[model samples]
Target: MTFLNHRHSSFLRSITQIVTGALLFVAVVSSAKAQDEKPEWKAGSAAVVITPEEPTWMAGYASRDKPAEGKFHDLYAKALVLEDLHGTRMAMITLDLIGVPRSVRENVEQRVEQEYHLAPASLLINASHTHSGPELRSRYLLVKRHDAKWAALADQYANDLEDKLVALIGTAIEKLAPANLFYSHARAGISMNRRLPTPGGVTNSPYPDGPVDQDVPVLIVESPDKELKTVVFGYACHNTVLGLYYYCGDYAGYAQEYLEAEHPGTIAMFMMGCGGDQNPYPRSTKEWAERHGRALANATEAAIIAHRTVVHGPLKSAYDYADLEFAPPASREQLEQDKESTNIYVKLHAETLLDELATSGSINTHYSYPVQVIKLGSEILMIALAGEVVVDYSLELKRRFGNTNVWVAGYSNDVFGYVPSLRVLREGGYEGGGAMLYTSLPGPFTETVEERIYEKIDELVQEVSTR
Candidate 1:
């Protein structure tokens, strides 16, 4: 009887020890899972319709003879503010317009700093390069038509837009909440290299063999409960699918619209990549635009579905200007001759330069081009380059940065004109120099343009990466 009782006690003690060990292991695992699931970032997003209430002059194509009469859909300006665990914040504002003027960026930067205490380095303004959006540059209209009414309308719209954008940023920041960030990418075949090489020169035609960046990079933001919040995706293609009189965001707008519809209560923002020389094929109709938009949206969705890298962050941002030199300005005699030409754009450009020479004493030999870099922990490196950047920059940067999670965006901050790579510049094409005939800038950039931009980008990247 004593031996039996001792055996029962030993059995009970062993069972107790086993149960306790199992519980301890379970507790340890649960704690680790909880820690892993904790949000590493805070994010907020807001979007506002920017479509003009009244008849507004359209941007992109200068050939349009009249103001916009109707609408395919309303345009938009969206803001997304992201904060790291340490409280470093970065605000990304995207416009469904032709470009982000330097003036607009400067104004927003100054006001956001003053009002919201958001540093200029923390602000990133990108444009969709939508050809159908309202003309934000009053001077372009003023110089082209010499109509004060048109210029005033555009100027008034721009001023109102500034206020709207600033308020939108504030709203986004106010709505910040705990969130998770992710990075993934998928490919879409909508963009084709428009810089076709021909015996004549580089014509703006589809070059199937030419390099293109069709990889659509996506940044997903979601709540801790796994509710999708914001989807920010990027594509390296011109948003010039439909150049109709009515306002539209083209394929970009359609993609955002589709994404938002598919994910109810979510905001989608499109960032233009280095697609200065890329264009969608079979374009010019609203249907085609919608098709391309759907394609891009599908690609984004696929990216989201794919395994995504967890974007851990103690976000760091840096911004600076690159002094991009213009090739020597056309001589006075050349300008004088150009002013007398039959081409209105050429004459206007020459007259604009001559006026600048008269007013400022000399033509501007260099432009203070804006360059920005944002590093998300050690996982992601985002480099935003101003102007209509060519595809080469995108490909080269990805190559140089190892292409894993590096995102290079163009048409950011100040999309003054085309930014051709050294290859494109040496090739001598529309993007190389001929496109300058349409702008008031003094023709092609100097050879050092690419080098100077790269130098600044490297400096900024190093500055942000270290912190």
Candidate 2:
């Protein structure tokens, strides 16, 4: 009887031990999963003045804004650093300039990569496309006159800008802690498609029927203490408000200023969307610019108050590049007339093309375009593209893959020139063929521009989805 009782006790003890071990295993797995599920977001921001004090040639549309006599306005350049909790990072530097030359962008990128070990795709540099700013690249085509003074100044400015950006990124990383990201979108109808359809049913007339991305996407950054640190918003409209000589960030800059003012202590970053063929309608004065800025700020405030969608969990990012070539311009004889004309931009570009054609015997074709996509956990996909992208790309992407989870950005990677669709190319307007004279490209993009863009985007999306 004693032996049987002892055996029963031993069996009970073994069963209890087994049960406890199972519970401990489950608890460990659950804890690990919870740790893995933590949302990742780290951010930093810095701003510098890239505006030139002296009068310089402005870029963007051919229209020029005369500078006020002996007066200068403040112009600003800003950098925003975004990274996952694990330290993988990306930096976006927005300049208050007309455009940045490819060489300038590449040099800065190389420096950043060498210094910080940042991937080229992870660093996105963009221009506000402010027509009131100085000309970074020579707009003249025929006479290759180098503004050594301006070039030297620009180089120094870029270097300074890079250092400031790096510092800002570092600060953001250091401040990273428990935070939450919320996204909300609203459409503001201030932007109108500048490319219109002609009476002959031909598209690309300067009449204003082109597609516009009115969706004002807002990303609200909150600290662990539940304070709003920043509001990053994007719109697809050219900031041509107050197009006067003194350097200014234009409507985009005003918008950021207004937002930050309204929400004291909160930073506002404006990511210009696909506004190549879009403009802020009724923009002719500084007051109008302020009004537009207020509208955007109001929209952001509404999103925060009404519907805030918070993003949680780890972040995943992916980037890819594609080379799309442009077809050679018209024959030298055909282009010579334009080249010899007073329009230095056209003349210089024509001569360059002619020289290339003469040397290669055939016009060189194709541009190496890059498309980058970043996914933040299961929510929010940010797609960045090169060039002055028109609104069609943004609209199409949002429509195809509901705007709730996608944010499309332009003026990213490289700003070689305007990137027009096949439809726009066929129509042959400024964004399509007319603007080619402003750049060093041999000619307008080949008809395959649309195909190449679509294919690359598709590949990028697929790659992210699979990952």
Candidate 3:
């Protein structure tokens, strides 16, 4: 009886040991499988000098009498390429120029698709809209100055820019490596509404009581080793802090410069926000521009140090064009009358329209405005709107998409002219249609401008979210 009991105890102990060992083995296998299946991010960055080598005519300010004499610093075209775990890629290119010309966008887009197999929806191009950058539109130069030399120079610079941009995109793609992304925001009070309300109408001056967007959205990319690689930040103010004859990136350029200097080996890119009707206070001097840049850089640093939401990804993007109808263009008779106006801009605009009528038989009836949406996992939703977008659009979208981190970027893809909200259009200010005199667009967008834009944006948001 004693021998039988001892044998039973030994057998039970052996069985318990086998069961425990098997359980431990299963747990180890499960943890290894989970780590292998986890998703990761990859990112790359590159920048190239884009400032024209010659004395080129400046954009934005039509009253400038001559080409640029010098530059405060060289302008840049920077590219940031991001790839997700599934190998899907997106490229974002930011320029320190006044605007992204349609030609440049088309040229670079076609090349990137052909060379890198990148989809059209995955490319985002934004311009800083600095008033002191070189004017790249040959037609505008021809109409304004009527000098063939100036037009030729503009054409040459544009062609060179197209080549440089294509090469830069390639470099960024080649450098892609393991990375981590974070999204955070801070506010800076540098921008104010420039359309002041008066008894007569809305004038081009700072309005203290008008609506403004001071939110500075930032995206920080770092290596697996926790070294910062790139910082992309945005502000809703015109990069028009200085308008001197010297070529400069204005506040946007200085902001990027300061950030890169403060953090060596890190690339900093600036995206323009909805600041069509906003301007910096105490502008028009180099010192003011630097001060504003420092302020913005400090705000960006604060965001970096603050709590950040990790940006995860199966990255998704959608892009489409909104058919924005135009109001009736100026009649031939009206153009003839305005041709004799004392204001050079008014006269030049009329003459240009007259030439357009002679060439095309009618002014453009509508514009195919571009609208883009990009989703970084479930945490961040970035909307890039073309043209000089007004603050109302940004404010409204933020309210509508309050559940996610919404970053609205204006002056993207195409910067043909001002894009006014329904309120701005109804108010009939410069951003509404008065600024159209400077662009080839015939007149202010119809009231459906805002509706059409929102319709396209909503469609894109739905598409990206579902995907």
Candidate 1, residues 1-467: lDDT per residue as tens digits?
Answer: 46668779889889999999999999999988976875999999999999999988889998898899999998999999999988989999999999998888999999999999998999999999999988888888888874678889988988898999999999999999999999999999999999888888888898999999999999999998889999999999999899999999999999999999999999999999999999999899999999999999999999999999999988999999999899999898999999999999889999999999999989998889999999987778999999999999989888888844899999999988899999999998889978888888988999998999999998998898776
Model 2, range 94-184, lDDT digits (tens) per residue? 7767665666667777777787677776777767777667666543411456455545555555556556556655555555555568888
Candidate 2: C-alpha lDDT: 0.72
**Alpha-carbon local distance difference test for all models:** 0.93, 0.72, 0.92
| TM-score, predicted candidate 3 vs. hidden true structure | 0.91
Off by over 4 Å in 1: 1-37
Runs off by more than 4 Å, candidate 3: 1-39
Ranking by TM-score: 1, 3, 2
**Model 1 misses residue 391 by how many Å?**
0.5
Candidate 1 worst ten-residue window by lDDT? 1-10
TM-scores of all candidate predictions against the true structure: 0.94, 0.83, 0.91
**Over the full model, what C-alpha lDDT does candidate 1 score relative to the true structure?**
0.93
lDDT of 3 at 278: 96
For TM-score, candidate 2 versus 3, the one ahead is 3
